[model samples]
Target: MKALKKSIYAEYDVHDAFQKIVLLEMQSYDGTKKQQLKAFLEDMQRSGCISGMISQFIYHADCKKFYIEHLDDLEDIRKEIEDCLGEAVKDRYGLPHYTFMCWLCFEEYCYDIYRNSFE
Candidate 1:
């Protein structure tokens, strides 16, 4: 993965940093390589690196790649998410993709949404 010098949410608040990090990581996948991204998410979930909530959310959001413009809707949930993830989300600077997954898991805790599977 290429190092992200600056992020899409660089001008935004620290709470939105996960959006930027997710975007940077998504750069590795394109429409043609969506399967690889999906598989990676699935494996991460299976290995307990990502929670079931995040894995389901990704599938529901169809996040084969990141959508920079869609991050606005997530703002309302940011603080709740940060709080749920605690120290894992403290630093908005240079967070890796794996860490971002932890932040993503906060969505479930924040919204009280849980799904057994993405299907």
Candidate 2:
């Protein structure tokens, strides 16, 4: 598992201060990718990481991708997902090749822009 490129949607960043959107792509296997992704999402819900935050879980079967919108810290959510994937790998669970994209928030974008300009 690895993380892919990051992106930012200005509207979401400005309007939704406490939330973020993420795209996760997983390699398909035996047509069970959706089920596996749902299970992982359930695990996240049960573990209290996404207790009241997750707003959406959309799966695109044709591309084996998921779009998740949640109100949790972006880095924290990414770490949790990576940790779960690591565990799955260790257990030899149907490890689907995966990648994650974390969209930046307004404040984050400002900071990044400032830093880049200075550098």
Best model per TM-score: 1
Backbone collisions counted per model: 0, 0
Over the stretch 1-119, how does candidate 2's per-residue lDDT look in tens digits?
11111223233432243222212322222335444433433334343211322333222221123323333344444444457558421212232222122222222332332233323
Task: Spell out the clash pairs found in candidate 1.
Answer: none
TM per candidate comes to: 0.27, 0.21
TM-score of predicted model 1? 0.27
| Candidate 1 global lDDT | 0.38
Residues 1-30 of candidate 1: C-alpha lDDT, one tens digit per residue = 121223222344432544344344444555
User: Which candidate number maximizes lDDT?
Assistant: 1
- Poorest 10 consecutive residues by lDDT, candidate 1: 109-118
